[model samples]
Target: MRETLLLLGARRLQVPAIHVARKMGIRVVAIDPSPDAPGLALADCGYVYDLADKKQCLDIAERERVNGVMTLAADFPTPMAAFIAQQLKLPGISPRTALLSTNKRHMRAALSDANVPCPISISARSLDEAIHAMKSIGGPVIFKPAVSQGGRGITRLEPEESLNSIKSAYEHASNATRGDGILVEEFVDGPEYSVEALTWDGLTTVVAVTEKLTSGYPHYVEIGHSQPPTCSTYDVEQLSRTASSGVAALGIDWSASHSEIRLTCMGPRVMEIGARLGGGYINTHLVPLSTNVDIVGAAIEIALGRKPKIEISLKNKAAAIRFLVAKPGIIQSISGIEDVKNLTSFNDIDIFVNPGDRVLPLSDADGRLGYVICTGENSKSAIEAAETAKSLISIKTV
Candidate 1:
């Protein structure tokens, strides 16, 4: 008899994990608030309840008697996954660690105490406190919600920006967070990268490094990413070391972690760590294409208490995904998608909005109109393929 796994969240991001579990003959029961969750169709059972609702998920997990619980990419499900695992005595990261990984202040303090390099940060609750933090941390800082994701409510503060600007940004951060607080950190100037790793039995395996591209300024949103990252060997080792330290600090074991780090003149400084796979199709699409490692399958196997074989089946291949952005208006028409799909390196394209749907400015990730995933012999070729595919497509607005 196959062991049952309780999967948290049923968005398209969860589809890869569901498919992997089924391929391993593991019975999957998924939970999500969306009735039309794409992953639901692939599950042995699915419950239409908020993945963050601990009571609903626990009730279902009890009924199913699931042997394991897992979620990927989605932040809301990380703590819930830990909660369910704790309730059922399953293999997973601790609830405390999961909670720490989600909150900015808590995560920063934990990493700092562990001697991990990170930005100078302070948590502020009021406008007065934020002002004091800004003065202390100096200007050219970034403020982010204590609990938020997808770059929502992230603001950059320059020396010339008005004090009221930070005040409004403080309100934005507070509104985005479940708690009424935010962390202000001195902005590190350098290239940003993401470190993907898996931990089993207290040993961390650094999988791949991904170079991140994001919209700059007050409201930054990830636009594209490529792997393996183009960086020096020393930078890779430093990033991996910092990520491992962060994972250890968070007490993450038997789990996969996605950590963001900015390489400064000093070295790699960790921005934050997520106790799950990197989102934006990094693990599901990029990692597999770049390294020939099925991270989703490995995560599932680890959740099932199985020893997953970790190996580099391929090297030197590059994979990338570029998101489509449109002006803030009703889309009149979209063309060239069919033509772009015929490109040699085109993996897939997903258009989120239709002709009649209104496109919002690139404030948050929700503004993404579509995306293209591609793989090539090298990072340059992969990025070129994605860019070419993007250039061919057109979203007209009026």
Candidate 2:
């Protein structure tokens, strides 16, 4: 008998997982707030319900008698999905671990308790506390909602920034949080990387080391990623070890994990961790394109309590994704899309806005115009190809 798998999100990022589940002969039950979510049409059955409503999703899971529950590219659904899995005795992380992973403060505490190497962090619910936390750190720092996603409400501050700036950053984080409090932490300066891995019980197997490029300060929203970053073999090994330790510290079991690491002057320190596969199409495209490992499918297997096949079918290949951005204005025209598609290295390109549409300032990931994915013989070439693809596409705005 085919098992029913409950997907806690129906957004574009979760669509690939839905497709993978259906291909594995699993029944997909997707839930989302929007009736027109792209993944809804692909699922065997989809419910129009808020994923944050744990009781409602639990009811649906019970009604469907789902054998597994999971989510990707989202944090809101982590706790609920884990709670449902715990209630149903399905294979997944514990509800406590889910809370620890979703809330940045709790996660920092857990990592600290486990002696995992990470930056000093503090939770601040009010502006006064935030100011104090910054002073305590006594240097450059980061302010963000404890439960933020898509890089929303995250700001970096220099040590010399004024009180007004701190207050504004506090308000930004507080408003974006909606519920979770604010967190202030020492800003580690170094190259950033995300380790994509699968776990069974307490063991973690790394599949990809993704090098992250971001829009430099006040906001560090990701701009691009290259799988198997152009680093020495030792650097990759260190990143994998640090990220693996973070997964263990978070008590994540029977799931896919994406752990962000910073190679600091002292050593490799974990920045954050997720109890699901990565977002920004990293799992859906870049991972598979580079290593031939279907991470989304592996995530499904883990959700089903099966030992996922994590072996890399290919090696020495690489993939990259670069976001498209434009100056804030009304777009007049877009060019080079056809040219981008014709490129030998081109894998895919998606443009969100058209002529006469407004392109807002890039505050976070949501503000991105679109993205281009490309392949290469190695990470360097892959990144260069992605850059070339971005340059070819011109967005003229007024």
Candidate 3:
């Protein structure tokens, strides 16, 4: 059987790819360090291996003679994906560009040097250097791991906060990384949106523009996302253009790209770019529902050296997804999903956690319990439905 190698099989984004590949009659070989990864259950064959170990992934891919090797949602695994593809002579992006996408500092340097509109960034290996860099960059800066994903180890340090606290946050972020390095950048205060695009032969085709709503204060966790972003047509045009330029600058070819950008007063500044599908099921569920674009299928096609069939079948409607979060503690029970599904505006609800599972407060991707997806004729209606669905679900903790 022809096989496709999927790295980081536990990730939510990989689930859709596995489903799509299976439907297309392609066997999936899932690899991850975690044995309990959700995607393992659906894969035709599963292997437990650290995704960061490029040699192991390459060996397995070669052994299986996998047609393609790819990852969804996670940037750290891109390097491994590229390495496997390169070793197996499969279709994938170059290792240099994949490395650029994985490392924020390197990505920023490449984009900025190419004259792409990205925020100025600096790297610090220690807390002292991070503090000094923060002072030099001025206050209200965003500190994050140089090579992390899902908003882990990201903290916005305001000028009013104590230096000691800022240093602690930097240390915490650095310590969380596989490597002891942090990235500090000037916080571009503006509305944020993400552009999902697929590139073929160096030409980027914009798939969808997603407006991201996040908890504005201490934690920048994403609370919700709505498609056909509620921004002006002018802003949308700018975002698309900027995303295209950024993707080209990174030299990505025949790959799916998810880029986050802020509409700053100066113009659109790229927050970060990932050389993979969007997490939180944005590409899998939300994009298809909102734009009639089969992003998952397109990603698989691109990986297989096929041109994606991009079409805008669904129009004049919006779709939104809201994540359910709770205070830090063990989950006792969850109720109201049935009640939520019964609502007039309800569309779909997925719960990722079960009773007795310990839950953490919303800080990173892992903290989210589940998501409520809703659709409406317009963006406002979609957002309202999503919010209403969120309100219906109640999480109880002990």
Candidate number achieving the greatest lDDT relative to the actual structure = 2
List the pairs of residues colliding in candidate 3.
none
- Per candidate, the number of residue pairs that clash is 0, 0, 0
Off by over 4 Å in 1: none
lDDT tens string, model 1, 65-181?
Answer: 999888978887899999989998889999999988988889998998999999999999988888888888776888889898888888888856787897888887888887738
Measured with C-alpha atoms, the lDDT of residue 26 in candidate 2 is: 95
* Candidates sorted by lDDT, best first: 2, 1, 3
- lDDT (CA) per prediction: 0.88, 0.90, 0.84
Please give the lDDT score at residue 388 for candidate 3: 89
Give the TM-score of each candidate: 0.97, 0.98, 0.95
Tell me, by TM-score, which candidate is best: 2
Candidate 3 lDDT trough over 10 residues, lowest sum: 3-12
Model 3, position 322, has a per-residue lDDT of: 96
Clashing pairs in 1: none
Candidate 1: residue 292 Cα off by (Å):
0.6
Residue-level lDDT of model 3, residues 52-127, one tens digit each, is: 7877877788887788878877777788888877877778899999988888878999999889897768889887
